[model samples]
Target: MVNVFEQEDIMNTLKHMHKWFNDGLINPDAATTDQGPKWCVVSSGQGFPGAEVSWATGRGKDVYAEPFAGPLYSTTSILGSVNAISASSKYKTEALKYLEFVNTDETMRNMFAYGIEGTDFSKNEDGTITRTENCYSPATYSQATYFTLYPVAPNAADQWDKVEEWNETAESSVLLGFNFDRTNVETEIANCSLIMSRYDKELYTGTRDPEEAVPALYEELEKAGLETIREEYQKQIDEWLASK
Candidate 1:
């Protein structure tokens, strides 16, 4: 399956994904997964499961496939901001024209999959659209809801054109929001987070001693940047709680 996480949210999403796959899909012995031959078309993420330590060398076969998804700072690839503060306003219409193109007034479909026109989906002879995927429905379900920060490319296989009339044109909620600062504790958090990582894998795989390992982990985190991170987080939480 294609990646569901988008930009700035890949790291956290990968943690959940790792847990989901480890339950049954990954071959713990092989340190790999079971999605064989399934091409992983990743978008805007990084450090996918099993990439750092598994099936990379030796004669071992990959139990699953994973693609890298990062450096994805923008969808600026296909569209340009019509209201860009350029040195001159000469190209204003040119930018707007490009937006119009991707908006489906020009291209019938988006780079993301819209659907396979007829076999698996179609515009019902009744002026409505329909899809016949084995057990999923974009009309009622989607992969993007989980990671609201980014949306996966639409399925190109569908060949469905963009519904220009329905695109929710709006400003992004976080467009001008301030990002939380944690550089002061980044180093500590990284080291302590590593301990937590090991703890998670060990707890799930039932290798490390849970009682001993977990407590030891907290002790280590206490020494790591965790306390500082906690304080920072607490400050934010306190502010939000007070406001509420």
Candidate 2:
């Protein structure tokens, strides 16, 4: 609910990542070595309804991209939505339909729930589109807009069914059920997020000089939850993975 990334540096960094995405730099198959700030690019559609609509409505573009830095942490209310549905015994039938509604609704698209219609677009004489927004995405700390977006499959553009398919992949990917008991390190986790907010973009976007930037992040991250958080997360993840 509270936007922790309301800082100026972060916004600019997101815009910078946009430049690379439009250039076609991000690829999923790229080796891990190629996945960072180098030539790497992060790409996603929209997380917020307002933004998702905006991103998809351009005239003729097949795909558009947005950059990221943070994984865009989710509020418990948001992530726990599926859990509540499951508990209520409606997750299988009702919740899935709702997700479908989110993906294929024209009313939702016109509303720009996806993102603001980028600046370069206009209706054409043939009723097609004439858009020129050239935006790119960065591979670091980008968010799908707001965490509340839950558009279903068909809500995507007529030409972009693959995007919806990809969503299924994301939804079905590993790490579905597991809980984080951060009581021992809640402060550290919050603090690390707070501290990382300061340098996430500047360092990754090349504006802050990575060498100087990373060290500062480390010092603060330690106070926030560096070792403890990682240890705890890893410990939990290991147990969860083993159970699976």
Candidate with the greatest lDDT versus the true structure: 2
Off by over 4 Å in 2: 1-172
TM-score of candidate 1 against the unseen true structure = 0.38
lDDT of 1 by residue, 85-111 (tens): 366868877866754554443113312
lDDT of each: 0.43, 0.48
lDDT of 2 at 102: 51
Candidate 1 residue runs with Cα over 4 Å from true position: 1-93, 104-107, 110-178, 237-244
lDDT of 1 at 142: 21
lDDT of 2: 0.48
What TM-score does each of the candidates earn?
0.38, 0.41
Task: Give lDDT tens digits, candidate 2, residues 157-219.
Answer: 332344444343443324456677888888887888788777765544444444455556777
